[model samples]
Target chain A: MNESNSPRLDRQDLGKIALVSLRAARMIMESGGRAQVIAKSAQTVACGLGAEFLGLRIGYASLAISLGDDANMITRMVVVGRHGVNHRLDQAVRRVVQRITTERMTPGEVEVELDRIAQTTPKHPPLFVAAATGLACAGFGRLLGVDWLAFVPILLASTLGQHARHYLLGKQMNPCVAAAMVAFGCALISSQGAKLAGSDTVNLAMIASCLLLVPGVPATNAQTDIMDGHPTMGSARAVSVLMIMIFATAGIWLAGAILGVHP
Target chain B: MIEAVEHLAHQAFFGGVAAAGFGILFNFGTRDLLWCFAAGAIALGLRTLGLDAGWSLEAASFVAAACLSVCVAGFLHPRLDPAPDMIALTGCIPMVPGAFLAQAILGLFALTSPNPDKEITTVVLSVEYLLRVAFTICAIGTGLAVPLHILKLMNFRGSAAE
Candidate 1:
């Protein structure tokens, strides 16, 4: 009983886990893995500790992982999914602190769990997506002779709005929101660009460039994984992310179509 | 000599920025940045000297960057806390086929005089670009891991000798 009572984690162990997890997250992103992989991976790692998987959800650009023990004790980990200058850092710190204090675990153990959790969390592509979109929009805006600065706000609004919509509607509602925001943003920027530059060039450039912002590259990565011999895990991840992307694309296209914005 | 240096320098700077952007996007470290820059410089110099075989130049540069990054990082270790992701990501970014993707998409959407051959070629080019990016990434990763292991061995040996 006394042996069992020993602390489950120490500070050093936590640090190691954090380091490992951070590295893992880095690897997953670099390797083009999906976001769900992170949560799934973390769950796998946490299984050793007898933590039960509850569910994972993305809320306003944050990912929440729910866990429960066999005895019904519950805990939820809310992690900053994307890299943001202010809010993300704050949330990450808060989650880390909460995990340490609430679990009655030592700093080391907490770090380990946090690290594992971070590692297991899939790569956040939305941040990059936003940045890329911003760049593409700016370039297109310039081509169209519109004020490039205007697109910046649109980008930020769409990114933030998408996150809010995701949280409210859950995963199922993501595609619609993604599609609408993208289409609306693109059309607004393009129309404004056309007016300013008095040239259709800007609209054409923006429309074409925006294609680069699609999630197809990573979808291809998922396909590559299956081709390269990680079928079961690859297929599971591939199908899930593909569905999300499809929905997002559909949403954006729908908005464009409804707005009567044609290429 | 001056013209060559100027050209190499130009490539290095642009390559460095591209590489650095890739690093940040992928979460690499400062050491990766340094190594990537150095590798880019060296690769640009090599290419200037007329070693134009695509795979050879790419492979060599990647290996050079990985090895250099590991050595520098290992030597600096605790002090530098070099972010490997940054270096690796940036190092390869310059080589990614952005142009190919653009061409492919443009060909697919061209409304007038749609040429099937042009579209096919563009598509093939895009596919090739993707494969090349993947290969370079894998090669660089291996290059990084191997040298670090070697450095660890040397560190252990030196300590034992002392």
Candidate 2:
């Protein structure tokens, strides 16, 4: 029975509930959820489990949560992992939160569900993602005035770059390093390869091929977070975006210099 | 006029493709991807129309983002909608001005090169492009933030009433 209806929860019970809510919050944060969203989710899970009060605090790398009803309360903090965009996982977490509030899921059951959501694979395979990214960069190239004949290089380069990024990330390479390497390779291919193919849009192809590495979402999210009153987390995201962009730009500059291409 | 319409349509279609592709890359599901595609098309189409009407890029992008945010808030079921911000952000991906950012970066690199004869034109162009990027991003953020805040306030009121 929930504490709201049953006897007072013991410290152990409060600890368990607190941990469960903390896990939920961590999952959302790791999935690139906004600070407000993460706090709301944690609070929802805690309250639905019969906690009368929840004190949730979110940071860039960790989250702490306290759950209590009356004299008994427990606080727990765990360092979350790297943040990345995973809309499916985020949506799954939302559904779980909904179920917890509406269906009265037990803390144990919610933990199991969170684990399942954590392990949920990407909706599309790597190759398909690569192809889509390739097509996307080519589309961007065309919009930027790349000729049809020159579009192939951007497509091929971005596809290969995305594949390489996926592979390197799978192997646990640093994202900055992976992005830099992929950008370098993509620029090299698009610039030199376009020339070889007799395409006149080498510069555009070179610029477009590396577009997949841009941290557009995170950059945008940073400003939104700051506006929404999460200055610390927003600044953290902004710094990360700047780091990735700097490294990727360095890679592109190096590749262009080697190929006698000026941006 | 017909040629202009065709150009706008073509650009809008590619914008949708760009958004859908990014949606996939971000792991949105099939249904959400369709929404993303539509949102992207709407955003880019509106921006193109604004541009044709003599709006600056920053103003056009701001209008597009605000309109898209409102559409998501107004049309989608609050409980059923996947993150509205995600849809808006992904749709605005096409308007990110990647080329301009790259150009700014390149200009900065040029200034760093050990050439004493580096022209004032390099400094001026770099600053101009950097400012453009900053203002455009700021516009998109403000555009998204205002409507989303309204949505949040509405939801809060609804919950309070209950």
Candidate 3:
């Protein structure tokens, strides 16, 4: 005769699960895994805790989820549905408590699930795309009277700018600030390259490569979101993306001015 | 003649494979890869047909590729939702203005610092070059979007009726 119904997850098990999740996220992000693949991988890894994986978007909201197998395995699964930072933080705390109370799961099981998820996450090709684009730009710069030495600055600036944006995003910084910072850093580097290399080729490569970092796709997605009838969400995303782009552009302009590079 | 065709085919294959690989990396399914390859192939074929009317050639090839993608999407939607990002991204790769964009930025630096006249001319050239790049990007995006939009509308209507 069971009178009480309470969900339980051992604290050790929960900590292990969180570790696995974070590791999985690191793998996906580093691998340039697409959203779908990441979602699928997350789901597979969290299966041991009878937890499901949900899809993550650029913004904090719009998390999509699917129920895991093993129905009635626990009292209740605390799904961190579509919510903001507050909700996510709450969910995290709750999950920790739940895991502490429940029975522990084997680490080997968790590792195996994580491995499976890693195998499924797709490799991102943007690195290759950027490299190819850089090479082509270097060639074109030479044709346009840019010196070979100029390519180094451009390469460094563009790559650094991209890496900075990624780092800022991971830290949950304001999108606008991230974009601006990345663009500005890229511009500063390019200008320095110009001065050092005594050629504008590096500047050319940096500027061109940095253009790919513009939040164009996100802007487009915001438009699509609006069209799809999510006005509030869409507008928020659009405005945020716009601000980011503006900051980025301004950063570049300001950096150029400081470096005494003519517009 | 045989060797020439083979060589062209090889280049086309590499281009298509590279584009398709990009699609897969972006999480696009097999259908996207197929449509992108088809688009690339069509663009190559059009080039062989002597359609060298400047920007018109690029326009026609892109539109053709986009329209073909729409058709493929429509035909395959019943089976799967083929990732739009994959198709659009890969299909547009052929027309990306990598060289032009680089040259434009370089041209910006080439402007004479002391001489206003030469500087003005260089700035104008840079602006013109950037505008062309913008146009090319917009054209490819629009070409892909329009057909896909139409297909979506049709599917919406079909679902509504059912």
Candidate 4:
């Protein structure tokens, strides 16, 4: 009864939950949960912390959340730090969300788990990512019904493009430019296979290699964002995807121009 | 019909394999790879069915994407990650406009060349390719989104107080 009656303790606990909940939303966004997921999860965290109402606003790189009844309310705004997809981290956040709401984990416990998850490296190593990129592109070549000879070039170009992407992104290069640069490099390398083999092989290699640079995530997000009633964010993402595509095309064109390979 | 079924299976297998590979690049959990394969196989298979039924390519893609989103958001992610988009987006890898994108670029190159002697046939073909590429992008997005919206409305109501 004393535990329930202590208003000061309750206030402190609620404050901790609000802070951690805001952090939870930021983490979710940073790990690839879109605005809708962030909004929903933030609200849930706030609710589990005994909020009567929750107001959440999600943005491209930031989120603001307010929780609790009118007079005793708390509001927090957190800046999303990183924007990369790591499903394992996303899973950890989900685990935290579930535990807090269901098992009623305290704020301190949730923070510890969140920190541990943050420290855990991505399950898929860098080598796997590069190798998988090559395999995926080659697989796409087979799926496209291209000749068997295209595999060598596709493999080479895709892996190289992927590495280039990793390096460029790590350097904090703009995604649009990174995509174009990666595409150009891939096309240039793939064009050599054309020179060695024939036009058919070059066509297949070029298509497969370019597939590695395709902005599937942004395009998908644009759609989801629009449907989720955040049309402005969706439009922005759609336009960004378009810009990336246009830049990638420019890269391919430049490579073709240099290599004297048209079509 | 047997031939069509064979073709469909072939498409599904390659599409699934390719999507699984892309999943690795996206850092999906090892366990989620199989789910990605299923998403790709089902999406491509459904798209093929729609095409065979005389639907437009965009229409087929839209339906296929919806199926994928439903599977990912409704069934798959609940057991895996919170972000269904991760695997679902990778699943769409096989359906990307790879060939069409290259064609459109080639067409644009031919059209944009300073040489005035470019063929009229080239201009016409480039326009077709560009339009198709644009439409396909739109189709993939809208397709992946509609089912997601439905799922969100049904499940994610934000505050538990609601």
lDDT of 2 by residue, B1-162 (tens): 999999899889988998998888888888888888888898889899999999999999999999988887666636326466688778888888877777788888888888824669998998998889878888887777788777662222223124
lDDT of 1 by residue, A122-236 (tens): 4436565345334433332332233444444434433443344334444554443554455445545544545455554443433433332333333333443444444554555
In candidate 3, residue A196 scores what lDDT? 81
Task: Arrange candidates by TM-score, descending.
Answer: 2, 4, 3, 1
Residue-level lDDT of model 3, residues A92-197, one tens digit each, is: 2223322422545454555564565445534345565344434433332332345657766666666566556656766888766776687778778766876787
Q: Best-fitting candidate, measured by DockQ? A: 2
Q: Pick the candidate with the highest lDDT.
A: 2
RMSD for each of the candidates: 10.4, 2.6, 11.1, 4.1
Kindly give the stretch of ten consecutive residues in candidate 2 chain A with the minimal lDDT sum: A1-10
Global lDDT scores for all candidate models:
0.41, 0.82, 0.47, 0.73
Scored against the true structure, residue A192 in model 4 reaches a CA lDDT of 84
What are the per-residue Cα lDDT tens digits for candidate 2 across A85-117?
A: 888888788778878867867789999998887
Q: For candidate 4, give the DockQ.
A: 0.56
Q: Candidate 2 has what TM-score?
A: 0.93
lDDT of residue A144 for candidate 2? 82
DockQ measured for candidate 3? 0.09
Give the lDDT ranking, best first.
2, 4, 3, 1
